[model samples]
Target: MLVGDGARLAEAAGDLQELGLGPMGTTQLAYLDPPYNRGGSFNGYDDNMPRHEWLAYIEERLVAARELLAETGTIWVHLDDAEAHRVRCLLDEVFGVEAFIADLTVESNPKGRQLDRFFAGSHDRLMVYARNPDKVVLDGGIAAAVNPADFPHVDSDGVNFRLLPLRNTNKRFNPMTTPTMTYPLYGDPETGAVAVDPGPGKVEILPVFGDLTPAVWRWSRDRAVERVDELVCRTVRGRSGTRIDIYQRDRHEVGRIKKLKTIWLSQEVGSTDTARAELRAAGVDGFRTPKPEALMRRIIELSTVPDDLVVDLFAGSGTTAVAARDLGRRWVVVERNPDTVRDVILPRLGLTGS
Candidate 1:
C-alpha cells in the first residue's frame, strides 16, 4: 500500500487501523528516511523548517509509528548531522533509552563535501531502536565480502588465511593488567616448534616477546593450547636479530559471518553516485539524494526476514519498496509528493492505486 499524504500520517495510521492493518503491534520493522532539516529544496517537500516545528513533526510521526511496531519490532531512522543528535534524543524519549540499539554511521559520500572551517561531511547516521529491547533478538552474525588480498597465506589444509601475532602489542597490556594471559611457552629456535614447557632444545617464552617494554598475550595459556592447531611459529629477522614469533592462523575460508560494526563505508554500501545511476537506468528522474537500493536491501536483510512487513514513511524514490519487493518482503510506503508517487514511484513499482 502507498500513502500519498505523509505530513498527516497520524490520520493515515487511523485509516490503516480501520482496515485491520498494524492495529497495535503488527509491523515487523519500520525504516524511516525522513527529510533532514537542512535549508535545501526538494522536489515537492519543504526541507527547511523551524527547528521546533521539525522536532514536533517528527515526534508525532514517531508516536504513530511506534504504535504500529510489534513487541519484537525495530525502527531505523536515517538522518544527517543536521538533526541526528536531536532525533536521537527524541527516539530515546519515545522508545525509551534502554531500547536504543545502535547508531550506525553510513559513509554515503566517499569524497566528502568541503567545508570552509570545519571537517568534511561525508556520512549519515541511522539510529535503530527496538520496541522491547529485551525481546528483540538481532541477527548480528551477518556475512560480508572480504578481499582475498588481505588473507594471502594458505594453511596446511589448503585454506586461505592470515597469520596474526599471538602476543598483544599494546604497551598498556601487561601481566598486571591481564593476569590470566601471562604464561610461558617453550619454542625451538631451530625447528620452529613450540611447547608449554622448557625442553632440551626449546627456549622458554614469556608473555612479552621482545626485550623492550613487552605486552601480554590476548588469550590465556589453556585457551591458546586448546586451538594450538591453528597456531604456528615463525622465525623473523627483526632489527635486533632473528626471533621466533608465534602466530595464529586466522582462517578466511571458514566462519565468514562477523558481528556488524558501527561504520559502513560507501564501498560496503552503495554511494550517491551509484543510486543516481540506478534511478537513471530505471528511467526515473528529478529525485535528488535518493538512497541506494543496496543500502535499503542491507537494512531489510539485517532487520527482517522473508514475508515480514516493512514500512517506509518517507518513500522518496521508492527504493525501499523496490528492495523489499525484490527481497520477498511486504512493504507499505508513503510519499507526500504526488508527482513522485504518480510518475516515478508508481511507474517504477508497476502500481496503479495508492
Candidate 2:
C-alpha cells in the first residue's frame, strides 16, 4: 500500500493497522527514519524542532507504529547522534525496557562528517524493539563481509578457503560427553586425503588436545562422509616437529554468512558517499540524508522474511520501499513533504519523474 504526498505518518499507520494485512500483526517491521532534529532544513521537511517538541513528535508516531505490529513484529528506529540517546530512553518508556532488542551501529560515513564540532562523526544507530520479546522472531542473521587475508589457502578447484580444525576444542565437549564424535579418521598426510576407514599407508588421526586428552570431532561420521570433499589434511611445523591435522575448508562463500554484529561496515551496506552517489545516479535530488537501498534491505532481511509487511514512516527517496520490493516483502512508505515526494521519492521509486 502506497500513500501519496501529504499523508501523515500517524494517520497512515493507523489506517494500515485497520487493514489487518495479517492476523498476527498488521506489519512485521516498522522502519522509522524520522527527522533527526539536527537544526537543518531540507527540501520538504524541517529538522529544527525544539527538544521537547521533537520528543513529542517521535512519541506520537512510535505509539501509532506499535499498534501496527504483530506479536512477533519488531521496530527499527533510525537515528543519529543528535538525538539517538534521547530517543533510546524514550523508546524504553514507550515500548518497555523488556521489549528492547539490540542497537546497530552503522558506519554510514567511513570518512566521518567533518562538520561535527567535537569529533568527526561516522556512524548512525538503529534501535530495535519487539512488541512482545517472548514471541519475537529473529532467527535470521546477516551476511558477513569477506576479507582476502582470512582466506589464504586455495583448493584444487582454485577456490579460496581457510582451514578450520576439525576437533572441538571446548573442554565441555569431549569423548566422555559425546562418544559418537570420538571416532578416528584415516588420512594420507602426503596426499591430503581423509577417509573414515584406514587403508594401506593411511595414518589414523584421533581428535585430542595438546595434552593428548580425548576430544570430540566437530562433525559426526555421517556428516563428514557426506561432505568429505570439504575436509583436508594440513601439515604444520610446531615446537614438537611436523604433524598432520584434519581441517575443514571454510570456503569463502560458505563462511561468509555469520551472525549479525552490532557494528555494520560491509561494502554492501553502503556509506553516505555511496548513498548520495546512488541518488545522483538515479537523477533524484533535493532530499538530504537519503539511505542507500542496501542498508534498508539488510534491515528488512534481518527483521522480517519475504511477504512480511514493512512500513517506513519517513520515506526519504523511497529507499525502504525499493529495498522491500527487491527482497519480496510488502512495504508502505509515507512522506509528508509533497515536493520531496514528487521530486525524489516518486522518481526514485519510478512512480513519477522529477
Candidate 3:
C-alpha cells in the first residue's frame, strides 16, 4: 500500500486487519514514504511532527504492519538519514534485530550540490524487516533456484555438463584421504592412467608423477574405475593452448558471489533514475527521492520467488509494485494520496479502481 500521508497509516492498518488480509496473502504491501519531517506536502497533509509524536506514530504503524504480514511476508520502510537511526531502533523493537534484513542506502541525488559545513547527504535509507522471525523467507529467488533445469550448462550436450571441481581446494589436501591427489594427475581414467588419448582408439598414459612419488590416488581404485567415463579433456587451438577438462557432480558455481551486504548503491541496481523519471512524467511530482526500479527489483528478487507476494510499505511512485509485477511476483499497493494513487499511479500501472 503506497501512502503519501503518514497520519493515515493507522486507518490503513485497521482496514487491512479487518479485511483478514496479510501482506503476502493479499499482495498488500504498505508503502509509507511519508513526509521527511522537512515540512513536505503529502496530498495537503502535514508531514512535520515533533520527535516524540513521530516515534509514537512509527510504533503504531509497526504494530499494525506486524499484524498485516503473512507467515512469509516482509515490509519495507523508506526514510532519510534525518530519522533513520530512530526508525532503526523502533524497527528493532517491533520486528527484532534478527528479522531486520537490510538497512539500504540509496542515492537520492546524483549531481546535486555539496554541503560545505559537512559531507553532502545524497542518499536515503530503506529499512527492510520481516514480520515473523522464524517464518520469514528472506530469499526472493527461492522458486527459481528450486528447478534443476534453470542451471543448465550451455555448449556441452552430455547431460548438461557442469564444470565442478573433483575435490574441495579450500583446505590443504588431506594427506591421508587425498594421497593420490598429492601426486601429479595421470592420463584420462578411461585409458587406465592415461591423460592423453591418441585419437579415440588409443590412450596414452603420460608420466605426470616421478618414480619416487608414493601416495594414494584421490579416489579408491574401484571408485576411479566407476567414474572413468565422466571426465572431459578440453583442448584449445592457436598460441594460447588452454588445456583443461573439467569433472563435475553439479553445476553450482559456489564461492563466485559473496554474501549479501546491507548498504545498496544505485549502480548495483540500474534503472533507478528511469523509475523516478516515470513518476515525474506521470505528473506525480515532488517526490524528492524515489528508489530506482532496478534497485527495488533487486530487493524483491532476493526476498521473493516468482508467483510469491511482495510488500513495500513505502511505495513512492509505485516502484516496488512495478518491479514485482515485472518479475512475475504479485503485489498490492496501499496509498493515501487519491490523486497519486487514483490518477497517476493507477493509470500507469493499468489497474482499475473500484
Candidate 3 residue lDDT tens string, 247-348: 444444432223455656556664346556767776666665566777776677666768765655445567777888899987655555566666656776
Model 1 Cα lDDT, one tens digit per residue, 77-101: 9998889999999999999999999
User: Candidate 2 or 3, higher TM-score?
Assistant: 2
Best prediction by TM-score: 1
TM-score of each: 0.81, 0.73, 0.63
Give the total clashing residue pairs for model 2: 1
In model 2, which regions exceed 4 Å deviation?
A: 4-14, 18-24, 96-99, 132-162, 168-236, 240-246, 249-256, 352-354
Which digits, one per residue and each the tens of the lDDT, describe model 2 over residues 203-292? Answer: 989887655667889999999989988888867676655666899989876535656778988476898777788888998766567788
Give candidate 3's error at residue 272 in angstroms.
6.4
Candidates 1 and 2, the one with greater TM-score: 1
* Candidate structures ordered by lDDT, highest first: 1, 2, 3
lDDT of 3 at 105: 71
Rank by TM-score, descending?
Answer: 1, 2, 3
